[model samples]
Target: MAPAARRTRPSPGPGAVGTGPAGEPVHPAEPVPFAARVVGWVLAVGGGIGALAAFVLTVEKINLIADPGYRPTCSINPILSCGSVMTTPQAEVFGFPNPLLGIAGFSVVTTIGVLVLAGARLPRWVWLGLQAGATFGVVFVHWLVYQSLYRIGALCPYCMVVWVVMIAIFWYVTLHNLHHRHLPVPGAAGRGVDALVRLHTVGLTVWFLVIVGLIGEAFWFYWRTLL
Candidate 1:
């Protein structure tokens, strides 16, 4: 036999984590195998927190209704008063408690996360559905944030938790959709999405920081008192 015929195929170098089985470098565009797990954990943890916060807010609202004089435990200060925000018409945008929606949405998110973590590969339609849900959540949270800062003139700690987790869940879900082509990938937009996907953590950190800045600016006077 010739020397070539006797030669075995090459293997990935010592640190070549991205190489395929035949030692070829995988496409940069290919999703990492571990991404499913990361998405799962994010969904599970974020959804769980959002759900718990929503449930607490629901219970607090109920108690407040039963006793108009009741002060919510989360009503820590004038600036951070859950009761004040709860009483606002904005809290029931659909003529029902906003947290009721959170309870339902976040529960589904948690269930989907558990399924993914258990090694279920969800279909594209399912991913799209999650993307739609996350988009709505992120949008709604922003509206609530705006109302809290400007109109309601108070903050709810539990609602803030929902905001944070909704941001995370939306960011990750968007990244996932882009990577898997569940969303369109065209031209410069595609490249931009690819860049975002590669540096997702940085993007997420910056996103949260912007929100923090907005919160700080909105409540700077109160925060200054503590300083």
Candidate 2:
């Protein structure tokens, strides 16, 4: 006697990671924002790097606490000094070290991304949650950027790594959610949103360029000194 074959639900497509309310993926006129694996890899790699930077920053902070005059290994020079940035009140925005938040947030991001990479069919709400987190991460990173350039007047190398990774993840995740309709598009602005979604890489490139220009302009004196 042969055992009967058991039926199983088919997995979502490689290009689409999440499911709609009816357990189906919405196919808009535009291409999928990105392949599921692409998003997974981005999230995994970005989150992992962000977490590592945050961990290093935390260790530096701890060492600094142990010795008041301790200089972080990342304190390469005057303009790029982690020690200067760590000594500022801005480093403890929530009465604790900022890297603590990074450690917690990015760890979750990495876990979810790995799950998606393993062919997990995340729900629409989960995608929405990622959208929300990415939004917050980008906003916070920008605020830190402003504080670093204008207020703090110094850049942290480890922090810069986090900034770059955070911007990329935010940009891609937002695109994914928008294209999947998890974030939804108003009837009148549907076309506009679609266009924005299609120009994803362009948007990211321009964003990075703007940041570079700002940094150069802000630190022109020290940058020229290096030459």
lDDT by residue (112-199, candidate 1, tens digit) is 9999999898999999999999999999999999999999889999999999999999999888988888888886798888788779
Q: How accurate is candidate 2 locally (lDDT)?
A: 0.89
The Cα local distance difference test for each model comes to 0.91, 0.89
Best candidate (score: TM-score): 1
> Candidate 1, clashing residue pairs?
none
Our tally of clashes for model 2 stands at: 0
Give the C-alpha lDDT of model 1: 0.91
Q: Candidate 2, residues 103-210: lDDT per residue as tens digits? A: 998998899889989888899988888888889989999999999999989999999999999999998888778777788778987787788766877898999999
Clashes of each: 0, 0
Query: Which runs in model 1 stand beyond 4 Å of their true positions?
Result: 1-31
Model 2: weakest 10-residue lDDT segment is: 26-35
**Per-residue error at 129 for model 1, in Å?**
0.8
